[model samples]
Target: MATYDLIVVGAGALGAFHAYHAAKAGQRVLLLEKDQYPIGATVRNFGQVVPSGLAGRWFEYGRRSLEIYRDIQSQTDLTVRANGTVYIASDSDEWVLANELYDRYQAIGYPCELLSKLQCLTKYPLLQPDYVVGGLFFPDELSVEPEQMIHRLIAFAQKKYGVDYRPGSVVVDCQSNYGGAILTLANKQRFQAGRVLICSGHEVRLLFPEQLADAGLVVSKLQMLLVEPVAGVTLPGNMLTGLTIRRYESFQECPSYASIPKPEHLAELQKWGIHILFKQAIDGSFIVGDSHEYADATKAEDLGFHTQDYINQLMLTEARRIVTFPLEVRKTWAGFYSQTKAEIFEYDVDENIRIITGIGGKGMSSGAGYAEASIREMGL
Candidate 1:
C-alpha cells in the first residue's frame, strides 16, 4: 500500500494543473487517468489562453496565466506562442459593441486596440471586407499546442517536483474514512491519501452522484475545425469575430450589451449561427470553432463529428471577411466539457474528499489559476 498527501483524479487540463502545483508545493501527489493519453476537451479544442473572454476575477487570472505562459517556454519545456488576439466586427452596430468592449477593457488596464476595417484589411489582406467592418486587438493574448502543453506540464511535474503519475489507472471509487480517503482503482488496487481532489470533468457525477446531485452540472458538446491557411497570408495572432463578442464574456461584461437593442442582437445571434474563434497554429494552420449543444441524455455516438451545415457556412462566410488568404478546411472534431449552472462546482464529498469541477468552457484560460486555488484551499 502506498500513501500520498494528495490524489488528483483525471489528467485533463484541470487535473494536470492541480498535480503540477501540488507537487511543486512539496506534497507527495499522485495523478490518475483512465486513458494512456489525454483525449478529452483539454486537448481537443484551441489551446488558447483568452484574457478577453473572461469575467472580473477570471479575467485577472487569465492575464496572469498569459504571463506565465509567455515565460513558461523558457522556465520549462512547454511550447507557448504569445501571438496576441484580434476581434473583428462585421457591421457598424457590432463595431459599436467592439469599441465599447475595447474602452471598458482599457479602463481596467487590459491591453487591447480598436482597429478600423481599412486598418485590418491593410494589416491582414486575407480578410474580405464584406465579412468585417472593424476589429479589436489584444496584444497580450496567447496560444499553446494543447497536447504539447499537457505533456510539458507532466514532464515539469515529474522532473522538477517529483510528482507520481498513474496513467490507465481509472478511479472506481473514493470515500472518506477516519482522517483520510481511500481510493479504489479499476484494477482492484487501493491507495490512501490525506486529501482527495476530484478534478474530473463531465464524469464527476459518475463517481460522486449523491454529493453533486444539487449542482445542476452537465456536459456540453462543442464542435471545432482546423483549416489550412492560405499561402502568403499570416494571422498576426489569435482571432475572434463579432459573434464571439456576443457569446463570450468579452461582450457580456461590457456596457455595449446594455445599449444594444435586444431584438436586433438576438436576430444577429441567429444569423451568426455559432461563435467564430480563429488562432494560427505554429504549423501555420488555423484552428476555428465552435458550436454549443447540450442535453440531459447524451449518447456516445451523438458526439460524432459532422460538417455543421449552418456553422460551416457561417464560419467560411465570416472568415473571408477577416483573412486575406483563400482558406481550405482540413479537419473537424467535437469536444465535451462540464458546464454548471452555478459559478463553479466545488463541494466536499466527505471530510477528506473534495470534488472541484465546472469551469464552463474556459478551462484552458483559467486551468492553472484554479488549480493553484484548489491546492491552497486543501492546505497543501
Candidate 2:
C-alpha cells in the first residue's frame, strides 16, 4: 500500500507550504527535512512578506499569502505580524520615481500612501532626517519572525491536520516503484507515496542536477546580518530606501524608473545588485544586507561555504548611509537559494514525481499562495 498520499522533500517555506496545503485538503502527507529543522534561505533572509513590492501575478500571489498568513495566525496562534513597508526616497531622481510609482499604484487602487518629507519624519521619528525626501508606505504588507516561523508553522500543520513530519532524515534516492514513488533515505530507509514533490531549494544538486541545469538554474548567494537596536529604539515598520527602488522588480513599473539615470553612487549600488531592506523583530531588533552573486549551475558545485568579507562590508556601509539607527551586529550569515530567469519553475520527471522550486526572493512573500495554486493545478 502507498503509505502516504504525498511525500514532500525539503522543509523550507516551499516544501512546508506544500505539505501544509496537501494535508489541509485531507491527504496523508509526509514532509521530509535533512536537518533537525529547516535552516535554509527560509530562515536566513528578511521575512518581509511585501505584496506591494511584487508585480503582476506574483503580486496577486503575495496578496493571497497575506490572507493565508492571517488565517493561520488566527487558526493556529502562529506569529504573522502586520508591520507594513516604508520605501524612502532620498534624492530628486528617487523622489520622481516614487511619485510615478505612487500614481500607478493609485490607478490600480493599491493601498499605498506617498508621504512628504515632513510626513515621513512625523510618522517615523527614527528615520535619519537628513536622508529623508519623500516616501511610499504600503499599508498592506506584513512580516514574520523568520527564525521561528517555519518551525511553528510546521508544528501547527502537524497538530491541526496530522501531517507526518520527519526531521533529520535525508532522502538520498527517489524513483518510481510499484505504481507509486519510493524515496530512499541516507540510512537505506524507504518510504512510498502516490505523489512526490521535490522542493529542495538550491540543493538541486541532490536530485535533478541535470534537469536544473537545463532549466538555467543559478545559485543566488546573499550576505545578510541581524542587529540589535540601541536600547529602547523602535522602528515604525519594514524600512527600504532609494537603493531598493532599483532592486525590487515592482518598482520597474514606474515610467520614471526607466528614464531616470542612476547617479554614480546609486549606480554603483546597482552594479553590485545590493538590496538594503530592513524588517524589525518583535523584540525591537532589526534584520537587514543582501548582496546578490549569481553562480552558473555548472559552477554551483564550487559554490562553497564562504561569505565575502568585502561584500559584507559594502552592505553594512551602504546600510549606514540610508538610516541612522545604532545597529550593533548581533548575528550575521549567508543565505543561498535557487533562481531562474523563468517566472515559475516546476516540472515532472514522471507522472508521479514532480519538482517545484525557484521563486527566488519571493519564497516568503508569495510561497503559500503559489503552493496552493500549484497543488490545485497538479491535482495531487
- Listed per model in order, the count of residue pairs whose N, CA or C atoms clash below 3 Å is 8, 0
**What residue runs in model 2 are displaced by over 4 Å at the alpha carbon?**
301-303
Estimated TM-score per prediction? 0.92, 0.95
- Per-model lDDT: 0.78, 0.85
Candidate 1 residue-wise lDDT at 268: 39
The TM-score obtained by model 1 is 0.92
Candidate 2 local distance difference test against the native = 0.85
| Model 1 lDDT tens row, 27-115 | 99999888897888898878888878888777776777776666657778577777788888877767888898888888879888988
Summing lDDT over every window of 10 consecutive residues in candidate 1, give the lowest-scoring window. Answer: 295-304
lDDT tens string, model 2, 1-380?
A: 33899999999999999999999999999999999999888998888888877888898888899889998999875568886889998888888888888888888787899999999988887778888999999887888888899999999999998989999989989899776899999998889999999998887677877887687777887788888867757775688888887767888887777787767876656766787888888888888877787887557656576877777777788788767777688877888888888876788999899998777888999999989997888786
